[model samples]
Target: MIEVTDHDGVAILSLNHGPVNALDLEILTELPTALARVADARAVVLTGEGRCFSAGVDLKRVIDGGAGYVQEFLPALSTAAFAWFTHPKPTVAAVNGHALAGGCVLGAAADVTLMSGGTIGLTELGAGVPFPTVPLEIMRYACAAVSSLVLTAKTIGLAEAVSIGLVDQAVIPEELMSTALKHARKLAAVPADVYALSKKQLQQPAVQRIETLREQDDPGVTEIWGSPATRDFLAEFMRSLGRK
Candidate 1:
């Protein structure tokens, strides 16, 4: 799931489930807890092991586990995403590789997102799923081209991602962590109370929308994700990718 290490006063949280680090229930459940454990740190940096920030949800698991899984996973997804988005300390995403669908949302949720050699975008629609309320709202708050990215379900290169505000900076792969730490440390230098207050103020509207609409919206999103048609589509989509 997640590996936590302390670098000076900054807590660096690495996604340790290798082979693309696809989001699953356990990973999602552990994420917020990991953030909570490191709450006293001045800042946090999130990155993935290997060449992926994440490839997004594990559709194979979804299709295999069926609706029962979707019911549990959806809430965990929202919880983890909301926690990442609202973390009081300075948060930085060191996106080292592909960040698609949920992965993109996780990166964007951070106060500062920096990437190296990855493509990033919202591709959930391509998988025949609608965005859940929290993820949709976070993208709306963080990305300048949320509508285009979500609708098209298309991933763009680092340069375009930076230009469009999907990420704040594009660093070389070798320098990704260092650059992320630099940004994190700079933000960490701000007075904690002041920084937390400003972040909360800036994010209040999106946070409000998430709180107000999630109970209303997630059920329908979960229903679609659990539908037979969606399951069939996901099965075919996985086959097309040469996955099981």
Candidate 2:
């Protein structure tokens, strides 16, 4: 579900699942492995293959697979997200298109997030799922208006996203990759050890919070996700999208 390529010294990790690049068990399970493969690269740029960064979790799969699937998927989600968030290399998110819910959290996990031509936000509440600890913490760390976005579950366009600190910059689609690479290269130029150390220090607070509360919070979140009401909501939500 991830395609890795090199641009100069930077590694570009592209999300290449379905059309919207929805997060599923296979993608979540493989994401950390992909990150590990690029560990030695000077920096990394994350983007999507098509017109979407990601549309978030695979709700159809969740609805079909039921609670048993959720038991496995939730932990995998946390593991993959934590891997991306804590990666030692400089990371940039080239959000080429829509990034909602978990996708938004993944983009925000990067050191810098830049978007072009798509809406982005946390839509978990609208989907009738609670945010797992890792993603919730990352959103709080990256976004200036986390509460409003999470509570409302409303998406905003690129310009508004930038204004609210949901994204650092907005560029045209053509400039998205180039701009992301430019930022990645700049960050790559910094001494690796110093950059990694500084990044760790900067991220420590969020990391600590995630580590501390995940055990307590994730079980409840998982329970809600697997609850019958959530399944019903997901079924209706998927139906609204004309998805089976």
Candidate 3:
């Protein structure tokens, strides 16, 4: 689930769902509501508990849930991504560990990302899963180098992630939260109405583009998630994991 804690005026939303914090329908559906609750907070920090920020979606869940779940899931997922990008208050992602696929997208979607001690990248290509509009736009809006993630599926280390601007700050594990809080407090100091208006103005184009692309791209990708070809690929990937 989601844990909301207040730090001064900043709200930290920590996802703690089993090991690796694999994102599931539960978190996807709850995230927007969480953001709504923190609307008055000066700023927000999103992170995950345990060893990894998230290993991405719960793959087994996806393989088992089939098309019906994808239909219900993508909308909620996209909405959460949009919320991260356009939250009236500034947001930061304190990446505690490996963030891949959807997890990486979550970090990239934030206003500032502070990652600590692990690899983070989009590995969607190898999984035969496609990116939805909002995640793609978040990456594009955040950094230009992320354009290559769609074409490759490799995990990048802390230096590489920072060099590519996927992460704004890199720190030792102990320093992660303090560093994130420092930035959060800095942004939170901005007057609420002024911060909201400027953040909206800055994000409007990207948000609008995400909405535009959602109408055209989300359906096709959801169809692919349920398509026979993708299912076969997922099955083979599952078998490979079993062998490991």
Candidate 4:
């Protein structure tokens, strides 16, 4: 679910789930430990090993008691991402492909995001599920970087990602990793403690909002997961995907 490699104070974290790299219980469960292991690195690059960066949380998981499976889930995943967001070191996202939902949020949370021309941010609004509040907060901060592209979702192109500020650099698919690593190395030179603290201060307001939402609304997860509207949305989404 997660793979980590380190080189000269730099770390690469790859999401390696099969196919679309959708966030699932295993990935969510294991991610925090992975983040912890390389938390001391001067820089980190997050990428995925597949055609899609991540298709977001598995809809099937949600329909089939995902609420139970992930009852302890979002907080863990959010905590890990928050670590990345405020890490003293710089972080880069080498978006290899489509970064929908959770995947998009993860990329945006990075200090700098680089995308292959094919990368896109899809919120899954069509699915009828409420957007995760944590990601929305992340997106709020990312607006300067990738708002227009995120807004268009499917219409996003590599140039669009850069123009909207979602990605610091956009490159050909084959060059994505090299570009990300190069950028990460440059960022590694920043004064770590200062950079980290600065990032924390810059992000405190958004983080606080996320915390409040989680605290107040998380208890409703079970009810929302079982609601008639949720069921109808999932069914329609499944049907659209031919999963029905």
Name the best candidate (by TM-score).
Answer: 1
- lDDT by residue (1-244, candidate 1, tens digit) is 7999999999999998869999999999999999999999999999999989999999988999899999999999999999999999999999999998999999999999999987888989988999999999999999879999999999899999988988899898889999999999999999999999999999999999988999899899999999999999998888877853
Top candidate on lDDT is: 1
Which regions of candidate 4 fall more than 4 Å away from where they truly are?
Answer: 144-155, 226-228
Ranking by lDDT: 1, 2, 3, 4
lDDT tens string, model 3, 83-128? 7788888899999999988899999888889998889888888889
Which residue ranges in model 3 land beyond 4 Å of their true spot? 242-244
- Where does model 2 exceed 4 Å of error? none
- Residue range 1-244, candidate 4, lDDT tens digits: 8889986678998999989888876787677677778878889888999787777777787677645654655565566666666666788998888887777788888988888855566555556655456666787887664444445445466787687777778778879888888888898777888787888898889888988887676556546655667867887888987963
Clashes of each: 0, 0, 0, 4
lDDT score of residue 160 within candidate 3: 92
Considering TM-score, where higher is better, how would the candidates rank from best to worst? Answer: 1, 2, 3, 4
lDDT of each: 0.94, 0.93, 0.87, 0.75
How far residue 213's Cα lies from its native spot in candidate 2, in Å, is 0.4
Clashing pairs in 1: none
lDDT of 4 at 107: 81
- TM-scores of all predicted structures: 0.98, 0.97, 0.96, 0.88
For candidate 2, the 10 contiguous residues with the lowest summed lDDT are: 235-244
Error of 1 at 198 (Å): 0.4
Instruction: State model 1's lDDT.
Output: 0.94
